[model samples]
Target chain A: MKRILATLLACVLLLSCMSFAAAEDKKTLTVWIPQYQFSKAEDAISDQDFWDGVFDPFEVENNCEVKVEIVGWGIYGDTFFTSLVNEDGPDLVYVTDNYDLVKRDLLLGLDPYLTQEQKDNVILWNTAPENANGEKVIVPMDDGVAIGYVNKALLKEAGLDELPVEWDAFIEACKTIQEKTGKRAFLQNWGATSGTSALMLAFWPYYFQAGGKMLNDQGEIDINNEAGLKTVEFLKSLLDAGIFTEDIVTESESVDKFAAGEVAYIVADLNKGNSAFTPAGIDWEYVFSLKGPAGYGARTATDSFAVNKKTVARGNDELAVKALMYITSGAVMDEFHSKIFYLPPFTKDASFVKDEALYALTSAHSEDVYVVEEFSAKKSFEDTLLANIQEMFQGNLEPQEVLTETMDYYNTQLKEN
Target chain B: MQKTFFSRRRRQALIGGAYILPSFVLMFIFNVSPIFLSIFYSFTKYDMTAAPVWVGLDNYIKLSQNKYLGNVLTNTVQYVLITVPIQTILSLLIAAFIAGSLKNRYGSFLRSVIFIPVIASLIASAAVWDTMYKPDGGLINQFINLFGAPSVNFLGKKPTALPSVAAVSIWKSTGYYMVIYYAGIMNVSTEVQEAAIVDGASPIQRFWYITLPILKPITYMIVTLGIIGSFQVFDLVYKMTGGGPGRATLTVAYMIYSYAFQDKRMGYACALAVGLLVVILLIHLIQTLFFKERDAK
Candidate 1:
């Protein structure tokens, strides 16, 4: 009877030890993901599907758990800002151009956490995130790139055989479309309620392709530079000729006008140019680069992801890091891009050309992409600059007035800060 | 005996305090504290993430310097002036008809139909109105085209955008004020109304002399709330025109939102908010003083 009691005690101790070991091995990672609903699509192709189809295997194989909370972009600003400041955020956060997290020191820099193998697997776009102090706090997850779209019918009506590649010919085509067809020649989205739209689609490409810089090394307004003057002069000429319309007050109208074939040339991203316009049966062509005075190039915004230090403090940092690496690795990224038209940067390991016919729809002419860099005091500058531009379009102010007033406003805001 | 009376009084006071504790706590947390915080934040440059920096009166100075302030103030006041009195008079007339003239079941059904817009989501209502006011393939345009009128982009053009948005506001709010007036008319002394009727008062005279005076308080409420709502109009403008066509529909409230969230200038937003509050209070004070003098006379 004594021997039997000893054997029972030993079995209980062994079982208890195994339970502790199992608890130490497994972990749970939480991610906040944004969702989009494509037009005419019944069920939303949500981010949860990403976890289920892509990350579920990663979770199972690693013997860990991943929780994906599908949030919408409608309330994303308030919700994300609240969670981040409170430091009660998720393990991984999905954000597009989130410089505040870096400026406020709320996020953990990913440079130290990434492995050599992990670094090689993903395209590290958005390398020069301003005010990050050279630390990559957020790694880009998807392309928010914008390229110009050509309406074939509108172009044909204007008697143009091919899409214009130079700035001069582009304006000429705009003039022809207006003179011949009596339709609006070109649509540059101005007076946009969304400040980002005004800058990204209308002004950024023009500024960049003209060799204009946002700021000098000393962080002063570089408004009087030759590049800026050249670009502003060009835009003013277009406005003076009535090539650009002041009818658009919102971004959605730009898309609607394009879909209705009301404009000859428009600048839009793939989702806007293809998903909305193509499905509506509008004959369209996509262009990446337009040669201007300085050079040939294009720059568009990028959507990205970042890790929270609160998750690191919770000791689930390793799991979150693994999740980011696994999802962005060349193996999964190709599959991810194949489903959506949001193609990643060129990687030799992945095959994005699923169909030869659809290849033109997914590729950009230039790999040179520019993400909007956000700094602490850039908001006031953006507001002042965009307001002047809008006024100029509405015939309230001229390009020279816009230029002078913008510099004055920039200086005033700088002095106050 | 005196000591026992005092003890009983203390116990009564304690019980009363216990009864009102929940509401007091809620008001303190939600309403009272926010007002104080808003006032404090107006003087500080408080970006949402960083620690606030003290910058006294700088925000207010900038607000004064803003070139668009005049337009925003004009738009807000114009909206209020257009919407409030029209809504008040219309709702009162409708409520009177429903209360006195309309048959039993029909009045209820009519009230229900009118109140439908009140209960419908504002965003959804804006969307439906947007489609109706659209330039092409719109109901309003389609109707106007019958008389050979050219297509008008009601929400798109600057001249028509503000008025178009205002019309939607009036349509949405008239029924809500009507219900309020309906309740006020019901509570009015029936005996007074009957005496006026027996004293050879016509139906119009009875309503004008008898019901209108009794509805003064309700009218004040409807008008004041209407003024406030119009002054702070954001959702319709946001959904319909987005304060666009060159700031035609930009209101003070929309400007505040732009400053606070989009521009990340929280101090300036709070300053604007405080300015709005002060203006509202002054208007109410004038209204009260004017009404008090009239009553005394």
Candidate 2:
């Protein structure tokens, strides 16, 4: 019995040592991707399956292990902050606005790793090498415009030949539709829990359309001036005209109503527009941002792949950058865009968008669509601004008060940041 | 003999210490260390990514100038006032009635039923309540419409949002407190109740005079726990309102979460957290003094 026990213990120790040796043979690269609408293919069985299909070949080629986690939007901030604070963050992540991360030096610069062709071919947005304090910290992944969706059936019922391209004409069309069809017109979602949906759809596009600059030369928020007040007053006019109501500030039921043809127009981004309207089988057309007093403007969304500096700490910086580049390559992104919804890919030649009309309209207005300045105070400013606008819609605050209060909060928070 | 006795006592003490050493070490690492670190971090500007810069009193000064601080504090106090008293009284009454009149199988089944919400997930409960409070075709709105009344956006209006969230918290918590009170009441002496009955005391009188006094310690404990719990409310408000409709339901805890996580203002959030700790400590001290005074009287 003693001999048998000794033999068994020896065998167990040997197996444990072998397992540890095997683990040490290959390095593990951790990646966290926030849950986007098109992060996975529609027909894929699960996120794990989709990511496995994308990463298996790369892992084999690199002779390393790739571990991926799909994080939800709601807890993404908390998860990333806590993990990075403990020095246990993933090697790479998808970041839309990297200002906060860059300010803290949490991201690894990708400029040293990028090939000249990658740099020249990819259309970088705000995080270009020249713009990011001379450190290229992100590789552009997808681009989208803040545009409105018009239900063609509803427009036909309302006796409009085409969706209005100008703000005044759009307002007139909405009012005429409300009067004739007795259906609500022009709904913007204010209650989206994440991503400052209201500010993107209802506020910033209009503010820019009215010729407002988000920041001044001194890097101060400059939205409390005439253009800001005008945007607020325009929204207030909508409230007074019964185009918006207290219900609009509640959780979003706008897309559902629009698909049901109870509403004629609703503002949405590319992914949300296609995924929502196409599946509902609604005859909807994209309306490039309505031209306003300053000509025309829309909010553009650009997200990128960011490598964490923790990759360098782990001695896998090159491996992580290689993986990021592979993921953002033209072929991979084209497949990704075609499988889900259409967003303009980073590479000029990568065009797999199924919706050509949307592609053309978005491209035509691409120069007019602008993303807000990258700053640490963006989230706080957007949240408070949304709340203040909601108050204005409730008739609790005047337009000037909304602008003043929002800017006050933003400037104060910006100082802390 | 004296030396032997002392040695035996020392041995016993050593054994006890050995038994408690593991838990003490764990507590020190996880709980005690974090408390001290939080206090230290409150005095510095630390974003967790870089070395903390000593910025004495800056975070605190910013707190004083924060325009939203007063509103969040008022909301938190209002939430505590609304939830704690109502839940305490309701749980106490229900527990007492069950013990006195319906101490049968039906009572046991009813207790189990009432305890259901205590076991349900807060997120799930809040989500259900949010849907039910929706303005368009929600359960409550649909029922109200039966009487030919217009739909009311219960959570969209500032006046109704906080109270609506409070209602959900009360619903979720009353059961847990009810169970505690039920156990406390079960431990009450039957002989005392019989003695009061022999003196020709009525049900109400016996309850007021005997059972209530016996449950005083339990009541104090329940109220203290309730106050702390209510003051630190986050999940219900987070799921229900997200501090929306123009900051109507913003609480201090949610604000701290937003700052620490969303805004990455760790030092400011730590200052806020330390302030919350002091407030809770003062509240507990006051509650203890009140209970002691009542006992002395």
Q: Which candidate wins on lDDT?
A: 2
> Which candidate tops TM-score?
2
Ten contiguous residues minimizing lDDT sum, candidate 1 chain A = A355-364
How many Å off is the CA of A385 in candidate 1? 4.1
Model 1 chain B lDDT-worst window of ten:
B238-247
* Predicted candidate 2, C-alpha RMSD: 2.7
Candidate 1 has a TM-score of 0.88
lDDT of 2 by residue, B30-93 (tens): 9999888989999998877778888999899988889989999999999999999999999999
Write one digit per residue (lDDT tens) for candidate 1, span B197-221.
8898998998888888888888877
Tens-digit lDDT track for model 1 on A60-160? 89888778887887657556766767756788877754655665677766767776555554555446253345656666654645677788988898788
Q: Write the per-residue lDDT of candidate 2 for residues A184-273, one digit (tens) a residue.
A: 988877765543656777788999998998878887667898888888888888887777777777857777787777788887777656
